[model samples]
Target: MKKVLTACLLFVSSLTFAQQTVQRSAKLPNSDITETFSVLRSDKKIKQGEYTATAGNNTTLAQGTYLNGERAGIWSFYNISGKLIQTYNYTDNQLTFADSTDTKGLQYVMAGVKTDDDVTVPVKIGGSYSFRPTFLSKVLTQAINKDFGPVANATFIHTFSLNSKGEVTNHQVKVCINGQNKLYQVDDSELDHDLTRFAPAMVNNNPIPCKVITTNTVAMSNGNLPDYANSTYLGQ
Candidate 1:
């Protein structure tokens, strides 16, 4: 009997803590949010010593490391059900790693966004209700302003999709230069990450997947955009 009990104890010890969400406040004014600091033990791997953000329904919205109350390292954003929507690499509070051609990577401004079918789209839910564009923009602006600094000189265009469970997927970004919509180089990692901080989407009083796209401009002192003449073709 002792041997059997000892074996069970060892098995339990191998498992990590249960996933949990906690409410936390930012020292900076008007930045309160729910944080999932749990060290979750997934079947494939164990995620320890990282912080995750969640909405009111306990769906993971963002995941990253925090140093002295500031976001650090590669942060991942998810839809309402924890699907990876976007990833942002940061260092010393500055957004980095803005160059990629992956579907989830940044793109030079191009002009072909396909339209969705006539199905009922998911609604952006906040707390016990849906979110208005103005409020959503306000929340996104706070995170962008804090992490990526000002963006008065460039436009960030981001697109993503959510599954029927309101989980985000198929994340992408694009950049525009010179105030023209035809900008190049994708540099909207911070914008995408911040946008994931909102509540999940819902349809017919139930969570449903949907697509989201947002555009925002920042005012920096630069007027010349990066010239990637050898850039990969968009269709590639």
Candidate 2:
């Protein structure tokens, strides 16, 4: 009788321990419900239920019911001022919203459009120009010939600017002599003369003003004669 009683007691104790282990692993629904009420407290993925996230008294940050971590239903987002910035319906990582017509608006903004007042117009200042690197090199070569002796070979740089109307307003030339040396600076007036006379640049279907820059060099042969070589140009 003593041995049987001891065996029964041992069986009951083992069953109780097993039940407690299962209960510890299982989570009660009410515990999750209690945690979901606080903001910034629960970062775990939410399931299908209604929840409100508020920024302040009047400003509601976001409010909606999420289904399996995906916004199955409607989701509304507000700015700090409580203004409705965007209302989105997200399903499987896809969003549906109104089409945007800000393409021209963006361009206008980039063109330096002022927004001080409601009424504004795109200022039509003047045209502009950008020189290709190849063109710049050619200009430099030419300038070197005029300033220095006949350049056998030369490397030049041209810098020009564009106005609001995309017109070339200024041009500057820097020339490297003897194929290597400190660059010689030339005035925009000189470059303007050459560009307007020989290589005029146009902007907005009109011929706008521009400047040119160049570097020159001369190659001496055994016979003491200079050999003219081609150079490169740069574009802005």
> Cα RMSD (Å) per model?
15.8, 26.9
lDDT of 1 by residue, 1-236 (tens): 99999998877764423233223332111123355443333322223456766554566666677543445677765554555545555453332332121223312221222354223333232211111122223334443444444344556666655565554455554555444443222222333243433323443445455566655444444332211211111321
Cα TM-score per model:
0.30, 0.23
Off by over 4 Å in 2: 1-46, 98-236
Residue 4, candidate 2: Cα error in Å is 62
- What residue pairs clash in candidate 1, if any at all? 79-168, 151-218, 151-219, 152-218, 152-219, 153-218, 153-219, 153-220, 163-209, 176-183
Off by over 4 Å in 1: 1-152, 182-200, 221-236
CA lDDT, every model vs. true structure: 0.41, 0.35
Model 1: lDDT of residue 161 = 57
| Per-residue C-alpha lDDT of model 2 across residues 1-236, encoded as one tens digit per residue | 99999999999986664343311112111111111221121433234345444432344545555444444565554443455544445443223331232111211212322345332222111011111112333344455555666444444454444443333455454555565544544233432221222222333434343333333232334322222222222211
lDDT of 2 at 210: 36
